[model samples]
Target: MLENYLVRGLLIGIVFGVPAGAVGILSVQRVLSQGAAAGLVTGIGSSVADVFYACIGVFGITIISDFLLKNQHIICMLGCMLVILLGIQCFRKKKVEKPASVSHKKQEDRHQPGTIRYLISCFLSSFAIAITNPATILSFMVVFSMFRIGGNESIGEDIQLVLGIFCGTCFWWLLIAVVVSHIRDRVTDGFYLKLNRIFGILMVLFGAGIGVRAFMV
Candidate 1:
């Protein structure tokens, strides 16, 4: 029974994380611009938010869920504005100069005080963006219902499911970070700049869509 719940949670996590939405684009952009660590940290933030919503779904935390649902419009509008600001920042970013020394660049990517601060910023931004989406909990609830997950279950089983979800989400993000980081060295400055702009535009569109949905609700 625990195994079944774990498997279901894993599937749910992967399904939710696979979408190339704003979070996905931000992950890719961070990997290309910053480093694998940055991308992984960003994804970790998102995974944390997923776990928060998953807990609400699995544990049936009605009060918090209801509050989020009730104020979804305000929350979504704030998220929309933040996302658009981020998009504009990305779009207007100056081109980075390629490091003349590959080995030196690799060394520089290692964690330092400044890098730690940057990673923290990345994590917070992604977390804030992800958590503001009240729809995340709804998605979790719907998927939980489909899997028959949340009724009369042991606390142990619910914990296992949430753990599985966190692991699954982290695994997906790790794969993304590794793959994108591997190719990061080969990408040219011009190509990186172009991708940043394209991703920025996409993120803005995504934010606009979210705003429209907020109004519809």
Candidate 2:
């Protein structure tokens, strides 16, 4: 029974994480700019937010969920603005001229004095972007209902499910980071610039769509 709960949770997590939303674009951009570690950290931040929403669903925290749903439009507006701003930043970001080896060394040095700051910035940005979408809880609720989860379940079972979700989400992010990092060295600066512009445009379009939806709701 525990295994069933865990496996279901894992599947749901992967399904949720697989979408190439703003968070996904940010993760890929970070991988191209910084390294695999940056991308993974960004994804971890998003995963943390996902776990928070998942907890609300698993524990049936109706009060919080209700409140979030009530103000979903405002939350979505904020998210839209945030995403658009990030998209602009991505679009305007200057390409790194230094060779990969030099950049890698500099990145290594960043670990010495600025590691905590860098990590916090990356993590918090993704978390903020993710948490603003209060609709995520609704998605969780729907998915949970479909899976027949969280109703009169033991605390132990719920905990197992949540842990499985975390593991599954983290695994997906790690895979993305690893794959992107492997190709990081082969890509030229021009390619990186082009990708940045492309992703930036996509993010802005995504934000615009969200904004429109927010108003329609």
Candidate 3:
């Protein structure tokens, strides 16, 4: 039974994470430009948020869902604004010249994200953006309903389910980071910059669409 739950969680995570949405694009772009660590951390942050939502779904937490649903328009507006701002920042970022280095090892290390700013940007910002998506929670609710979870279930079992979800999510992010890291060195910086601009434009468009939908609602 435990193994079954774990497999289901893994399937759910893969289904949720496979979409090349704003978060996916951002993760890849960060990997190409900032480094694998940045992309991995960003993906982890979003995954954590997803796990949280998964927990809520599995536990049938109606109050929180009700509150979010009630204020969805406001949340949508804020999330869209933030997405637009981040998109603009990415679009305007100037490429920095690489410094002359004595060793190949040093040059390699320079590409990885190590700064506090990058960590915070990748982690906290990703969390914020991910948590703002009420649709994710709804999707989880649908899945859980299909699986018949959240009905007089033991707390321990629920916890195990949530843990399974977290693990599954982490696994997906790790795969993305590893795959992207392998190709990070081969791609030219100019290509990354152009990719960033494209992603930025897409982000802005996504935000605009959300904003329009919110207003219409």
Candidates in order have lDDT scores of 0.86, 0.85, 0.75
TM-score of each: 0.93, 0.93, 0.86
What range of 10 consecutive residues in model 3 has the weakest lDDT sum? 94-103
- How many residue-pair clashes does candidate 3 contain? 0
* Better model by lDDT: candidate 2 vs candidate 3: 2
Q: How do the candidates rank by lDDT, highest first?
A: 1, 2, 3
What TM-score does candidate 3 reach? Answer: 0.86
lDDT of 3 at 39: 84
Candidate 2, position 212, lDDT: 94
133-194 per-residue lDDT for model 2 (tens digits) = 88889888888888887578888889888988888888888998999888988888888888
Q: TM-score of model 2 relative to the true fold? A: 0.93
